[model samples]
Target: METNFAELVDAEFALEPGITYLNTASLGIGPQRAAAALHHGADAWTSGRSTFAEAEAAVDSVRRAYARLTNVPPDRVAVGSTVSAHVGLIAAALPEGAEVLIADDDFASLVTPFATRHDVKLRSVPLERLADAVRPGTDLVAVSAVQSVDGRTADLTALRHAAEAAGARVLLDATQAAGWLPLQADGFDYVVCGAYKWLLCPRGVSLLTVREGSEDGISPHFAGWYNADDIWADLYGPIPEGSLASSARRFDSAPSYLPYLGAARSLALVEELGIDAIRAHDVALAERFHAGLASLGLDAPSRGSAIVAVPGLGRLAAPLADAGIFVATRGGRLRAAFHLYNGTADVDRLLDAVAGRL
Candidate 1:
């Protein structure tokens, strides 16, 4: 597996020489297969060889791929433009003055829609306490499966039990966890993920999976012709309600075609590698990084996550970026993430550089 991981970096990705990217948690490096799809699709469009049906085909392919990866039925997944837009449907459905429980530092896209609603009341807690914080009268619990800030993963099983006991619904944002983590989207009332970060697609692609019957009370306010039961016939309304899709497609945000075209191939790559393989590969690299940090007398959280954070080391972000080592700084921590394309060498390079500075 280690030998294969090293070969994959040169074969799959188009990263430049001297660049060591450890920021899959921020923006992923898409494989060449996916990049080629984008270029080819754009060229076809420019030459008038591409039809709208081709774009629809791309979206359908991606929808199916993501559903398979997350263990959900394809019809249960909703393709969309961004996480915020997908969450809007849920936020709009909340009754007046209902309380929503959320992790305080969760990505803004997951929190903003609900926070902006003056009619909804939000209670924020530390990620570790979020599940236990669920109480009676809490209408919903929203959280990330793997935290974006420092890769602290939520215990969704605990959260699920808490929500069930309280009669609240679960909204899981797997934006940072999806590609490398095993997920069963059926466990959550709704699952939302942005593709650019870990799923390795263009920025415009995102996904929302609705557990069957969970969306009945939610409005499909953003529904457009592309996701309508009949794209051509449903273009303009006084469109009968029957024109809406019989499943979660009714809640889909109109997809951006070219991105979905790229997404289809990138997602195929993920399936080819398989999540369990990717997770093993990624977590090993992270543990290697953690071990290296300990040898250097550096402090970091060791959560067995693909993403790692070095506390109070954010000053290194600028220097690392300058040295062609890409990473992110969040909450006074220097964040680094490992993926299937990374190996021990990348981890060692980061440690050597940090050792020099210290």
Candidate 2:
């Protein structure tokens, strides 16, 4: 059965009329449920209805939602403010003198944390060469599940096998692949994502998952009140030997209240719509967009993923924006990402604009 994605989610987004939004890779258009949740959070704060328990519950709700989406246990999910923040925590938790492997095109957040560490050694390899790059002494291998610039999806299963053979761990940045892609949470030892993009939520909330037994030797680099078993009790007395929360909750850092409320609602909406349906819908739109661009004598790197990267269109982003079509430019390619709210009309408009410009 053909999916009527427009009927399912178009009404829930606030995209402006005549403006085609294709920059979901850069940031997603906030859904109505997230906006309503944010409003409710504001009301609770202003009406004196907010409490510590309420805030903790909101955080737990968001964590559980992510856990469900990734098919991991709730205790394995750790909520953070951003992907970079969680990646930083992971970097800090690594053993001294650890060696890390990353791709040359990885987002700076993944590279910068380890790059700056004097005790850690960093190696950069091309995306296609990542599997071969894994070897003994490589403590961690990190890469995005989907490359942001070229729209290439990584084979996590293969990477996991290579990492395991080398006695290394895998960290996957699912910022570009999480909501619309079917992610197997067990494939990677660590998974991190920012909620603002494919998750269709506001910024300031991210989901981080640590595989079972993966947190064994890693200590929380940035511990806070929430990381403790009981904040008041810990504060009032000498900290007990095992006062920290037993699960990944020990790594939790406090985030702004508003984003969690909205994040919970955004996750609920995705679950309601069904992620498999969402992935199929996005792939169909992306294939149509690829075919349309091909007819216009333009070429894209890949066709099945949510992102379509047009060669040489990076320089035309401003012109496209002026035409009321939005996209992002990275690695000298124009990246147009399709989401549930996008339709055939948006693809037609993009193709027509590029054709007229050419």
Candidate 3:
């Protein structure tokens, strides 16, 4: 696996000397291709050479690319600037006084949307017990495919079954799972993700895939000219009847085009490398870290995940950062996430740093 990605690391990433980046769960370091794309977009922007049509086409191309990657129709995928915005659409569509089942301690963006809805009764459960907790009255089951805190993964299959038995819909936040994990939105009623973390896109790019026939249910309260069939035509006037797209585009927020201009190249890199390969590479590095932690008599549950969270080590995050080993702290745990660009040396450096701090 190291041999497979040795050259890719050199070609894709441009980390500073003596730095070890193991925080892809927080923000992915984009490849040179994506960087180049961003620069090109910036040049076009400053030169006033880019047209609205070109920008719209580029954004839609990424939307279609995401749809194709997830095995869904392009019409079902909506582009947005944030997961909260996408989740807000789903929250708005729920019936009054509906019951929403969610995992406790989930990411704020995933939780706040449904929680903000005063009409819904939210049932909180542990991610591990989410499936068993679903009951007869659940109107919806919302969870993250990968928990942001401890790297625990949700059992989507079981959750789907439980939700189906309760006549409920399923929503999944794939922000932490999409790039290295093979993800398809067809299994759930709705899927929302921020692309900056795992998908290696710039900030301000998000994806929302609404299941077919869900278009009528969701009211796009945030809809703007960007969602119109002819965005240019609807730029000024009050949008007339039939102006908005009939599909999920009705939910597309006004885009930050420069980010989407660079997104396609990043997504294309994922397709070229294949997610399975990236997953293997990432999980291997994480497993190595877990073993190192165990050898040092630390609590390291072997979860077979790309992210490893070490209990009682949150205090070391600052020290590790100062030493050029970057990680995150969540739930009072030191979180280290491995990506395709990381290698065994990176893992060993982190373990060594932790050992020194101890």
Task: Please tell me which predicted candidate would have the highest lDDT against the true structure.
Answer: 1
RMSD of each candidate? 1.3, 1.7, 1.6
Candidate 2 wrong stretches, greater than 4 Å: 1-5, 236-238
Error of 1 at 234 (Å): 2.2
Per-residue CA lDDT of candidate 3, range 1-358, in tens? 5565667667888899999999999999999998998898899889988778777777878898788777799999999899998888889888989999999999999989888999899999888899999998888888999989988888888988888788888889999999887887888889998999888999999999999965665887887887888777889877875888888888899889999988988888877777888898899889899889989999754287788898889999998999999999987899999998888999999999999889
* Candidate structures ordered by lDDT, highest first: 1, 3, 2
lDDT of 2 by residue, 159-209 (tens): 888998999998899999989998888778899998899988889998889
Winner on TM-score (1 vs 2): 1
Ranking by TM-score: 1, 3, 2
**Model 3 regions more than 4 Å off:** 1-5
Decoy 1 TM-score against native:
0.97
Give lDDT per model, in order. 0.90, 0.85, 0.87
Over 1-358, each residue of candidate 1 has an lDDT whose tens digit, in order, gives: 6466557556888778899999999898888988899999999989999988889899999999999999999999999989999999999999999999999788999999999999899999998898899999999999999988899899899999999999999999999999999999999899999999888999899999999979875788766676678778767765567888888988888888999999999899888778898899899999999988989888687468999999999889999899988889999999999998787889999998888777
* lDDT value, residue 213 of candidate 2: 80
